[model samples]
Target chain A: MSTAPATTREILIATIADLLDGVRTVAVGASSPIPAAGAMLLRARNEQRGRERVRVIVLGSREHNFFTNGSFELFDATAQGRVDAFFLGGGQIDGQANINLVGTGDYPTSTVRWPGSFGSAYMYYLIPLVILFREEHSPRVLVDKVDFVSAPGSSEGIHRTGGPHALLTSLALFDFDKEKKRFRLRSVHRGHTAEDVRAATGFDYDAPANVPSTPEPDAETMALLRGRVTGELSECYPQFVETLVADRAA
Target chain B: MGEIVSIEALAAQIKDGMTVALGADNSGPAMAATAVLLAQRPKNLHIVCVPISGIQADMLIGAGCVGTLETSAVTLGEAGGAPRFADGIRSGAFKMMDATCPAVLAGLVAGQKGVPFMPIRGVIGSDVLKMRPDWKVIDNPFAPDDPIVVVPAIRPDVALFHAREADRFGNVRIGRQAELAAMAYAAKTTLVTVERIVETSLLADERSAAGVLPALYVGAIAEAKQGAWPIGLAGEYTTDTAEVARYAKMARSADGFAAYIKGFAQRFEAVA
Candidate 1:
């Protein structure tokens, strides 16, 4: 590990890169800077190692996205099983991994409303690796059950090649088991413990007797993240990069 | 035949309670035409966002011009959550038909192809599917036990958008925003606002022809410089982020939203 302490955001990015191993193409949605950074980190690391280049498509970016036919091309490619990995965030996620991007209450007439589902309903089923990401880790977001399933974690008798592969939050990382339709706590981030994760999480999950802290990025990895990845991310997420720099200073 | 009309005249073609489709953020949204529509005070307008939308949808709902909205999502991107859209949905100001991006695009594709419905995978177990009784789950007849969700065709009465340029012959240059072409093809009538009108036909140039939406699909064209103001046209101008951020802040409350709209109307009226 580097002598300089790694920021929580950097650790999360490193964790995301770890999860994205072996992925050929990864698509990050709009307003998702961290995931986009993680994808870029993987691409940068691959370039360093002379490995196969990972195609990272960041939506809403003129430089990152190559889809000429607009969003239709992205959806078509996903339908044809071209997109390998995707990121989905929800207002609420349950023990079963069902996500709620819609709102808190019932159907059309809801007490509170988030942005409606973008493409999760389709992409979650087709993309082979779907990573659930939410920075805020608490019972409010990690609920017992989602009020509305924007996209189910698992479907019965449905042809689904993709579902929630793993969930990464500010506190910890959990891997989803498709057969059990449940999440198992993998590792807690630095400065957080298994007890903290259990206390904050609303849903029950299987946690091993001894959990390990998420590995910190080595000197080389941290150097790549600060240099090349940040530069590429500035095109779409200038403000986010500024904040990341500010966090490092703080 | 397509005719050159004023923005006000183009807005007049959109009657009360008509299903109107608008292009997404990157696909040149007719913000200037939208201003005229808001000024005219059309009612019960069913606004269909090609797949996703931004400030235009927020403004329409804020001004009470829309009775129903069907789209994948309504957001202001970096500006934050669309305050008006969230308020409207909370208060039941209008009916919201929640949909996924692909589903909405698939619906438009079905409408363009003159098909009753299009078979799409996923959304089987989603609450979005549960709310939409119109969407059906059927077994794929060709593949024995394969079940897929089919979305109904979303054929709008009129499609409205802004573009880089168009010819007097009504052919509009949409660039690489193919979803705009999808909306134009699916709608019964297509109205366009352009930055300028070219004397030469768009179809005449082979290089430019691929990106041109033919005059056959376009019902009328109105030349409005900076038609997609506040938003932007690719290679033309960038999004007015400061103005959008200001709108987002002002629109947090009902009174603030009205005041913002009032100022917007006045600003555009002064320009006209």
Candidate 2:
């Protein structure tokens, strides 16, 4: 019998979980369910593996966030280098890892306006590990160049301690090379090929001779993702849960 | 004890072209103030949203009350993007600062400290920096080899926020959201509207004193029941889903905005 294919969310979560390994602390911003789920799952795995319990701070969640000081508290934590990992997305991401949380085209007068960038630039500098996650892997998202840079992937001239560690797209995962200032295709997600990524991506990147397929989530991981993870995710992202998990079962 | 003003008196305090700062996001927005402001339609006003602005920004921008929106994000979260805000920016209805979230926080910090500017590590090479020339880059004073970015302080004329309750003495209790104090520090005057005014001792009690905003910071207090309605007041109630959706849909166009305001926002005062 053919097993139902894992979701794009699942693949993304697995990739994030892998990235989150050994990371002792992560702070999830508001309205990010996938990253929150991935952090929750990572915490579970740390417990299962008998490792040091990672401190996960899900902003705006009472159950997860212990700090009562709000975003200021989170920013303080980031500034202090206490937060080990974070996630950021953009309307457009270029080869050099420039992210445009701001809209496409000009500033103040944008051709297409996105919900303005919030805290990305600051967090990118403070957090030791920042993972770039954009579920949509298309030319529109992975572009030749962003119309406006919300946050530059590589701050060549700037005083900064943190930047993108890896970029996870639906089609593939790319590890950002800080020294070279470019992304290299680490692996392509299953059911997607390197050619597919090449065709969809607008930026040029160095490709390996043979790109490996991204690993699938194991039974234990899937079990947690479907059961406990889904339950916790529902509290924050009820609608998303209905579609990604509940609807699948139906 | 501070002055306990009416919504009308509060509305009177804001003038055209004033820089206003309101609570960020759905949690602690001063919707009653926003509603009154929408009715007044004072032009050329600038709003400083600490981070996400959501429906409050959308409504103000849609109604054309705001001249400049200096914010990081203005989306409605799971409810989807702020339609009017997106349209206003794409169509060039008003000016935008296009600040990142932490940058705004940093600016607030600078404003609170009464500093000329504060140095921050990020946005040194980002398009956010490129777009905002008003923000400056300076060589790290201690480290000549390193360069840093400094955001100018944002000092708003007014800071308006809604809280769960306030004492008769005008001490506001905002549990779990101590960041509200930063806005109070950044603004010349901080105005608050609360669900009700309890006895001074009620708020002064040990259990609630930690959440109390001393009367010293509050210039005016108004007892407006459900002051943050339509928008959610954290720990009190969730957002009115239908009302928010209705506003989002109706504020998509000029005619829709007028209709929406007349029906919901301004309607409150029109009846009064």
Candidate 3:
């Protein structure tokens, strides 16, 4: 196994940016900077390339005032629809792509109860391009059945409208199986294999033959990501970027 | 109805056609949604719903508090309930004017700051400007070269919040997100309901005073334990699915909602 450390944020940004190839009108939830930053980078790059730039709506709190600069708030890009895509994160996720942000146990006196499902419960049904990302994939998070389904998957009739389109993780990429109604491995990150991903996930996964590895960041994309990480986003999120830079250097 | 001054009294404040803003979190003070769900206010009562997350928005909209809702996104999870608030937008009953996450925060900030507008970047060539022409993207006409958009302020008429603890004087505290800050700024009148009523001296320490909503801004303070019951608190309970379904059902109809309110009052009476 290649034991080199990987910066989950970098990989996440690169992976999501790849998916942004032709997407427009993405929705982003509040309190998640990584996905929001990734969308911003992709939109910026598209604008420079003279391509039809993507627009993003950071839900709840205004885009700029909450975390980054105020400019991130303006209504500029010019896209149709509320948002076609979204990037999400959570504390615990199940095989069918259901998420649990409420708590680990019961309602009142529980072992762990998070602030209810931030925006997960609603957004999972709306955005056309739903990409749920999680930096940590432990036995606790990757379970056979979520203790609670804070957000529903295709099986719950949520997809009848619009549900999770994708699940991105630190180890691999996954998608919900519409027919059998389960999560299946579509691809693994570079330098990682199917078995490695399964081993990390305590639950059993239906891995397809020839699961492609996530593509490496191209030179142009990497330059942009690196520059932004070393510049704008880094300034706003100094500590997080510092940790990411340290991981890259290490 | 002699004195009519209690937690149950405010139910009368809500008439048939009022626009209300409630306090909501991942948990905490979903009381507004709960109250609405149980009370089953008339459909003629249109609410301009503004929440920090979609869960509350979904609860209220799905329940029907939202005759009109202006929000960014909902659901960060994969399953259950409606996928996105998009279904409402597509159906035509609901209209969604895109607001960037940062802009929403900035709008709330502007509301809190008492500023008319704040200059921001992005959305320069985007639909947000045209769709909501009120959100102007004007050039610094004096400095024609500089490009910026001035986001207008957002101040909701009333803010209703739920907290872990509060004094009768209306001082409140939230453990996780500064949900109260945004509510205080966004709304003109702020109401707080807490799980416990303690001496005002208990909040003397600064460290235990992080998310405190000042008494000055609070119009009323009610002691409602398990106020955020079904909805999970930041470190409290998991969401109560059974209650959500119950509320969702009653929220769908006016009669059903009235019954729910009467029943909820009975339940409150049972415990009271």
Candidate 4:
């Protein structure tokens, strides 16, 4: 919206905010600064518009989280259909939207181990809108098939009301087709083309004849993101805010 | 009633090859007790990180004290991936029981209720379900053709954690971190390291009583001021991010990890 271009981080934040539209209650897991920022932006905007305020729960935070019973309450609420949206990431993601939060290679003994799966297996099925967010878009990350399925994108005849809604990376945005169990390229972020996404991605996905560039945040949205959202996010993620400040200085 | 004991005594109670349950990062981990346990160097310790953990778990793994680790994840938060944990997994230093956060909690809940297993939704097709042969999948009794996964109860031999305070009566104040209570209830013995031990009953106050873990569950209590150091206790001190970053960097290799542990032991020794 402003003459100054949005940084890749800013673009990603706006994209997540857009994806979070109509989400009433969104919960973010540990160490997720960008998703937390996006949820904060949405909550701030909704409050400004005099609409019903969105409830953003960033876990491991005393200020933001409303849960008193720890993650037990969170899991219970999600099972009861209280939480509307959530975010998940993978060490490896395939075309089928299967996420591998575990390490590469065989089970029990992995070649390259990552942090074990948090609540992705349960949250992905319970939360109506689960966004697959991994900033890295390289072939190693977005693989043809994951070495391990930390949480499958779709289940056969499983009692699942929720699954992958979209996959957002640094290069592009892809919407997951639940029926077909595949990802469709929705839009490419600015400074990146569909070809760039294809080259980086390891698996195949559907793309339109003319893939549109992701829409940038408006002046108002950008203002809120830089001002109030950044201020709120600083409490939980000080280092990430410092980077944003550094980006501004640049 | 739980008796007041020294950290060393508490560590001595945790014998080798016992399944020890630890509190999560925000749930007041007993790092001082962990240090004593590291010094003791117990072998074949099966640690159950109640959902997730950080440097404390990694340190134990790096020190070669743990034989098996059951955790959802082990990370240093903003500091980055836990290098020692990754190294252990790569080298097969200990058996890793990969679990999701909810599953770990569910297993504890099952243990607390003295149930054989607890049924949970949404792990049907995941490899976490595939790997855990102990977790069973069966058709839902209420609904035909609907399937669910039932996780076996995880009753630990010992539950170790830190709390803000423990009264003379051994009722520890755990605040909003109720998962600590689950650990206490599910474990055979509960060892607590508290910042202070007060003469006045924590249960005497109406507000404080809501967050108190009763003496019936506590096996022993140890007074260790600023016990959850470096990681820091919530509302008391902030996590030393720089120190954790240093650990993350230095724990990348066996020698570096040894050096870090040696320095850590020296620091603790000097303090003692």
Candidate 5:
């Protein structure tokens, strides 16, 4: 029997952690610290209990440098192929799975300007199991066509690497329709209706009939995340950590 | 020779073994240059790469253009297990310069500012700083009021960046987080590769262009389309994870890596 319920973050975190099977390497970019830290902490904890260990690898500007003792280099594990999964985020993600971080302009200029592509450009084409997560679910984020494709997705073909297998958000999960060049909702959160998700998205989507609720995190995982992981990251990067905590708590 | 060049022409400026600083995140020009560098295979190009999380660096190290890597993290992907510039350090093929988080940026800032060294505090206790004695802790003479650690100026020979847009004269605007500041301050010459060319005058009036790199700091600017491919633009293309894995797998071995690249090149006639 289920003992306690899980929060949205916990559910998402737990889903991610459980979904990884025999994953040796995981690359996480900026805005993905929470998931990255969760995966690592959970993996380490599991290994300590004589469980299978996942050789967790995180990639980001601050990921390695945060470990004050080692001079973390970008190419330390630069050549490992065993990395099975990647986690990414974006301001706008289209149906083709192409994401945009650059501004959306008319022809040459855009009405909205955004940061240039972070690591998504490369990760989109390189990782096998790519999960594109977004904290917000607005029509603006789930768009029909991106003004710029900061990173190409399935549109380039299988030869092109790094297409998202799943697009996770606060409301639901999405997958790419290669033939249609659009995103389709795979599932919605429990108690949340498909209409709710569609209302938030700018584009039209088709939902699966038998979609299930995302699994929730156990008490231990939540406690660990809140107590140790969040605490450490907050201490390391106060500016970044503070906002995330406030957002999650709110 | 003209100060401004096309993206194709600018690629010629880079040769192997040249010490360069590639921009971090969205501001790096290395993304567009990746294919060119891989094709040319400039011998033993030594790069003090900063914050190596994206696929651009992955392609470089995977293709063997990188010799010495000074970075913070290599992302997990197909190339996660391959012999990388940093891994080469452990294997003794390439050199590794240990860099702390703040020091990484500070060194670039010092070089960008054209200063001999910049004083920083709190890094005195981190082991990363100790290993790099070149990053020394010194008494602040000018500020006899404080204790500080000196981050050596990193002025790499060249600093390369990718801008959203540029003028014929190389005036450019970088978006948020502007991964270029330290690079701009660090390199003797900073090269920019942009998505498109816009009028320099228009930038003067644009809100986003308020804080941009003037032609004074830019050595050259190149206009290239899809220059920042694979790496997703904020509102543009979603990243291709499969391609990242392929590069990672191929980078695992010398023969495999070469074959992998050759195969990739064959697939991208436009790039080749």
Candidate 6:
């Protein structure tokens, strides 16, 4: 590997890959391209380490996915605890980790409507580990309170095997405190500070003094991400690969 | 016991104001029936989708054939978000009953068994529980003091879907799309469009027997080749991504949607 710079995108992807250390299987959703890339990176690393088989299921890729019933199989597998980690995003997310995939104004009749929660509510409860990924980090998306709760981070009545493990944004990553029901700032990205995160987010969180910057993808990790991971991701996310890989090369 | 009829004749059975259930993503929409429904423009019709719906729902909403939609999500896939559905929902054009995928499937399964309701594990603390007033939370009779969410059985008047192939005796071979079987079983009448009509014994043969839907469930079958055009038929063809993108853009407005759908609906008649 040369001394080429690591993209913030790649760094974030590698971080997510590192999160999948103990996860046996990771299911990436239809709309998630970055998470898909990260899952592939994890698999690549696993193979490089000569570890046990790790299943990475990215929806719409024939080579990666072998389900007959599409999302139905994903839901079933999650319910049975087969899926160890999953990904979710939202139009708006709150301090409590409530995701609002519905939209801006209100229920049934939101002013700005996002796609209705497909199976976020169902999967959030079943999968033991969930990583909330949203690139757009601002007050608009990361809010004090979500307009609608598509899936709640903490719950009582429903039997949930898992909930939000952490929230990864462009600026920083926050660990969800299941006990406190609040986010604890884990680390800020290299280019940004805790104050920058505070200025943008509409919610409050506990931040340690002298917060450490998120580590960039090390030499070998970047190689795995750029080389094997990019190739594997091309089958499903051609546009993404072209934009990130080809354009970067050019 | 009519084993085969024209697609138009089959679509006619879906009267106005009737709630129709469409198949899941892999099984694909019954494009032949969908075309006729668009042409017929039956008012106040309600359609239920298991989870994610493709452009078929957008086309229906655009054509003013649907008064209500019950599904988890509706988008045009790589094409984009369903424009017509988005616009319609914003303008209070119809009713929407948002549900998660499994809840809808569980409802369909309950309907198939003619049961009052089926109990499920999740949805107890989410907004879905609050939005859906009908779905109840009860203490499990088997294990008292434990709360369980029960979904109401959603039996539709008719179930419309497309399959890979069917036998002359009306048995359908849907292969891996087992959810289609659940949809057909839940509806009062199962209307299907297939690519070809095989010998009645083809369904009984050991090789093909496993995927066949019994004749008792299917009320009508039609041979509409490439019936799931633009969308797709499982294991047959991929979705026409370009056409879907065009639909997504065109469906944003009334005139644009009308113009786009005109060609799609007309194309079905020439083949039929």
Top candidate (DockQ)? 4
Residues B40-113, candidate 2, lDDT per residue (tens digit)? Answer: 88898898887768888888898788889888889877677788888888788888878877777777788999
Clashing pairs in 4: none
Instruction: Supply candidate 5's per-residue lDDT for B126.
Output: 31
Q: For candidate 4, write residues B77-123 as lDDT tens digits.
A: 88888998998888889988889999999999999999989999999
Q: For model 3, what is the error of residue A149's alpha carbon versus the real structure, in angstroms, after optimal superposition?
A: 29
Model 3, C-alpha of B235: deviation from truth (Å):
3.7
**Model 1 lDDT per residue over A1-250, tens place:** 2346789999999999989989999999999999999999999998998988899999878899988897698889998989999999998999999999899886787777888889999999998999999999999999998999899999888888888999999999999999889999999999999999999999999999999999999877899998899899999899899998878878
Clashes of each: 0, 3, 45, 0, 76, 0
Error of 6 at A14 (Å): 1.6
lDDT of 4 at B104: 93
- Pairs that collide, model 2: A118-B101, A119-B101, A119-B102
lDDT tens per residue, model 3, A1-250: 1234435567778778777668867756545557766776787688778998687555433322332211222222212235677766666777777676544654323355344444454455545677888878778878877765655665331113456767788788887676666778888887778878888896676877888887776666666776653465653344456776677777
Q: How well is each residue in B1-272 modelled by candidate 3, as lDDT tens digits?
A: 11112455444454454545554444365464355444554443344334434445554554455665554344422223332243344454444444444455556668888898876544443333444566876676666465666778777766655667776556666554554567665677665666678776435778766556666676666666566655545444445556656755554454664465566645644432
Tens digit of lDDT per residue, candidate 1, span B181-210?
889899999999999998999899887799
Q: Evaluate every candidate with DockQ and list the scores.
A: 0.80, 0.71, 0.04, 0.84, 0.02, 0.59
| Candidate 6 docking class | medium
Q: Rank the models by DockQ, top first.
A: 4, 1, 2, 6, 3, 5
lDDT of 4: 0.90
Best by TM-score: 4
User: For each model, chain A TM-score?
Assistant: 0.98, 0.95, 0.81, 0.97, 0.77, 0.96
In terms of docking quality, model 4 is high
| Tens-digit lDDT string for candidate 2 (A1-250) | 1145567778788678889999999989888888988998898888887988989998767778888876678888888888999999888999988888877766677777788778887888778899998889999999988888777787665667788999998789999988888899999988889999999999998889999999888877877778777888777677778887743454
Quote the true-contact fraction of every model. Answer: 0.85, 0.87, 0.01, 0.87, 0.00, 0.60
lDDT ranking of the models: 1, 4, 6, 2, 5, 3
Candidate 3 chain B worst ten-residue window by lDDT:
B76-85
Worst 10 residues of 4 chain B by lDDT: B263-272
Name the runs in model 4 displaced over 4 angstroms: A1-3, B266-272
lDDT by residue for model 6 over A1-250, one digit each (tens)?
A: 4457777788789889987777889999886889999988988888898986789998767778877764468878888889999999898999999998777886677678777788887888878889999999999999999988888888885467889999999899999999999999999998898899999999999889888888888788888888888888887788788878754455
Which regions in candidate 3 have their CA more than 4 angstroms from the true location?
A1-250, B1-5, B14-19, B36-51, B62-64, B76-91, B94-97, B140-144, B241-272
